[model samples]
Target: MYIPELYKNENAEEIKSFIKTNSFGILVNQTQGKLWGTHIPLELETNLQGKEVLFGHISKENPQGESFTDNNEVLSIFNGPHSYISSSWYDHENVPTWNYIAVHVYGKIRIIEGEELLFAMKKLVDKYEATSKNPVKIENLSAETMRQINGITAFEIEITDIQAVHKLSQNRDDKNHNTIISELEERKDNNSQAIADAMKKQRS
Candidate 1:
């Protein structure tokens, strides 16, 4: 991730919360000497043995599924809010940059099937469906609809390492930092406002 010391975030709880909030991530792996990546929703969880892991699935037709062999390692990237930071907002002359948060997780793939796969799918569905006005339950699906699970490859990744970066103008002085937050908040876009909020939270 090439994170500088100034921008690195080492707080475990914070990083976990970030991942849960931004669970849709990019899963990267190599198959047949070619690197493949898939954008999917991953759930951070603890396995029966108390080891941290990520659970997700992809269609069986996806070529990336070929990479899910024994001992195969993979990389999952989770991105958070980001916004441009104009140098004009700083008290002194400086180059413009971007403020953002991201996480990189590396792990070994473990293909799951039978009840394990069904359980994983249930959890994934329940999590996202919570926000719906009329939330749908996986158990309520018809047999024909449930048959679609046969076409997917569900797997878990035993986490080996996690790297988190939070570049929110931490290098700036208090005056400049406050100014940057103000400028970001003035912008109407969601990313800008999110950066502003994150900066405030960091200071808090």
Candidate 2:
């Protein structure tokens, strides 16, 4: 990612938290002269050895998985809050811009099959299903159904490089920043709320 100095975020902890908050992201890979991408919620973790790992699974029938063969690399992009800022909202002659947070992680693909797939399934279920109104118990599902679901591909990305950016009006002076924040707060949209939150965090 080519991020301007004004929008760049160098803190790893901040970027990691942003990724966790917005866990659903795009996993992109290429194979057979074609590009493929999968949009799914991924589980991110740091092991005892202090290495970052990304875990996710895809349907067996999904062609995106085929792109992640033995040695193919992959790029996973985590996009957080984003809102369009009109130049009219600012007090100066600044052109329109976007306020957003995003992280790009590049790594090698390691496919996990058979028992490993089952382990990945359990991990996913434990992470997402536990918070539901009527929590889904994977153990409650029939053995055959579980087996069928386990047929999906499970993979992990051992991230080699990571870059993140937080463009939350940090480049503007206090006056302009406050103006954009107030204008965004008046909008009844999720992105606007996020921009407001980011602005508050940055100012703090």
Candidate 3:
């Protein structure tokens, strides 16, 4: 995450909120001298010891899971909305660029099993199901369904560092910034609209 000073977001609360909203992230680690990445939903949490950590799991069959040994460090990347900005949006001639938000978390990975795995899984399920019309609880699952856990490996990553980037054209002047937002909103796509909204919020 090479964030320029102008784009770097140092606000802890905003970064935490971004991670929670964009919990589905890419977990990267080295396996057999080669890098492997897994896409998964990671829950940001505070362990009993009061240390910040991430909880997630992957299928036992996933080769990436092997990298969790020896408390190896890992990188988790969370991405938010992004869109291309046309140079024409700016009043003065300038090169086109992009606007987006992203976060990178570095941590030490440790495999978790037994009750800890089950508890982590329960929390993950409960969080996602909260918005469902007919919510399902992990405890309500049948023994056979619960047996599926045997095929997966759960782990926790104790966070050591977090880097957040919010590249929302902060370098531009007020007129150009507002124009960029207007153009993005007119694009009518989710990413464009999201970037526009974020720009508006940043200004407010």
Candidate 4:
């Protein structure tokens, strides 16, 4: 999250969009004697304060969830598109560099169970299926199915701070930047290709 001025992303809407696209992030928390991290998908929401909030769940047996208490702070990292920009791409004799985008959200978690968890489940089902031709509504599901799904531990992170970095050769000369992007566009890797597209969009 230590983003240099050249790499910092100050666009609030872009940061939110990054989180939406890369919602599957590592949730890190420190407790008692150890620190733990779990990679899971999350639903983003706006809190009453109009701040980013993360809602996710874990298995009841996952001790990682119980650590979120009165004292623990949490951090979730959302890594977007990335690529390696070889020094060869640059016209000068500079070291190789990496071009990437990443966002980190810091907050405190409030663990929810029972009814709150149930509501979260219903919301998620609606979120994904609402746009489908045949929507699968959680509310209409059988009680047994609902019970099975809501048995896990659910939680929400009230995001207090966010840091984003988009190092897309912004500091480089136009020629070098174009060279790196052109190479990425020709690659087979979708991630790199996507990065190239995003960089091109930013440039325009």
Q: Judging by lDDT, tell me the better candidate of 1 and 2.
A: 1
Alpha carbon lDDT of each predicted model: 0.91, 0.82, 0.91, 0.81
Candidate 4 segments whose C-alpha is farther than 4 A from its true place: 47-52, 130-134
**Deviation (Å) of 175 in candidate 1:** 0.5
Off by over 4 Å in 2: 46-51
1 against 3, candidate with superior TM-score: 3
RMSD of each: 1.3, 2.1, 1.1, 2.1
In the range 74-160, model 1's lDDT, one tens digit per residue, is 999999999999998877888999999999999999989987787788888899999999999998999999999999999999899
**What clash count does candidate 2 reach?**
0
Model 1 CA deviation exceeding 4 Å by range: 48-50
Model 3 stretches astray by more than 4 angstroms: none
Model 2 weakest lDDT span, ten residues long: 43-52
**Tens digit of lDDT per residue, candidate 4, span 1-204?**
788998888899988888887888998887556878888888787544465578888887788867777455999999888888778777889998788899999988888776666666776678778789999987788888777765577888888899999888788778888998888888869888988988887787
Model 3 C-alpha lDDT per residue in residues 124-169, reported as the tens digit of each score = 9999999999999999999999999999989999899999999999
Best by TM-score: 3
| Tens digit of per-residue lDDT, candidate 2, span 1-204 | 998887888888888888878889999888566777789977787533466688888888888777777446998999887999999977767689888889998988888766655666676787788788988776688988776765678887888988898889887888888998899999979999988998989888
